[model samples]
Target: MGNFATLQPGGRPLVRFYLAFMLWFVGRAIQAAALVDPNVRKEFNDLPDDFSFSLGAAFNGPQMAIGKDSNGKVKYLGKNSNIVPQVKITIKSMEALFLLFTFRESTPVANSRERMTVEGNLSHACACVRILDIVQVYLLPKPIAKLAIKRYPKWSLKKHTINRLLINLRAIIGF
Candidate 1:
């Protein structure tokens, strides 16, 4: 019957395990803190109003499909066919910031005309502008809006252009 102190090997492993666990825990805490810092949130919120974002480097492919008949028959429509795709972009404004994203082809269209028409209609629709991470889109707080205007004196600050700004910001930030 040896005393526990005499069992040196077991105590060393336990101490090492505790130290490793503490190091891992500390590393995770630091990472989380960096992500949720108030300054980071504020910086994101304060991004330039003209910022825009795109899905990828290349231009998005044209979305197309075959025409459908009233009888639910598959119509083999050729390119520039009756069927076309729709894309929608939505921007929501949070406190001193704007968040923008896109929803595509949410609506069904019978032909290219309908698709083009819908797109045209949406072009004028204020909601269709695609700025991402806007602190405030509509009725922005006077100061914040003013700050944005000051940042981009020449730009229209429209949704489309704003989205482009956001896309660029995302790229610059590497986020």
Candidate 2:
């Protein structure tokens, strides 16, 4: 006699929710960073007025979008909004997203590994990645940030400490 067994796994809701929350927090941090960090602001200034970008998991999973307005201020546009973004960076799977967010794989490593897909203009995407790296350096502590960012920035006191504190506070307060 032979026994038959089959197994199929369902989606991970908790992972999806966690990724969504992280994306939201990162979006807010980016918005706040644009205001508090000169480097972030400078990057935003180089982009077009209508520029926008999104980071998310593929196949309509969790996501967050950020955009720069005519005034050159950046804002978190929420998840999967009706407004189409100029750049979209998508992780191939939940596992990949998990690894990236968990700091097991940095953005550059993930990109090199083919774990992410980028759409739209390449130059704009590179700028957005640089902005994100700056934000990560501000948001995370030195030890952990070194793992997440490709190259740790050579930041001064105001940028590494004062600006980091301001960015966190403003991001929490949503201004």
Number of the top-ranking candidate, with TM-score as the measure: 2
TM-score of each: 0.18, 0.94
lDDT of 2: 0.90
**lDDT value, candidate 1, whole model:** 0.27
* lDDT tens digits, residue span 127-156, model 1: 222221132222133444444332322324
Q: What TM-score does prediction 2 earn?
A: 0.94
Q: Write the per-residue lDDT of candidate 2 for residues 91-128, one digit (tens) a residue.
A: 99888998988888999999999999999999999999
Each model's lDDT = 0.27, 0.90
The 10-residue segment of model 2 with minimum total lDDT is 1-10
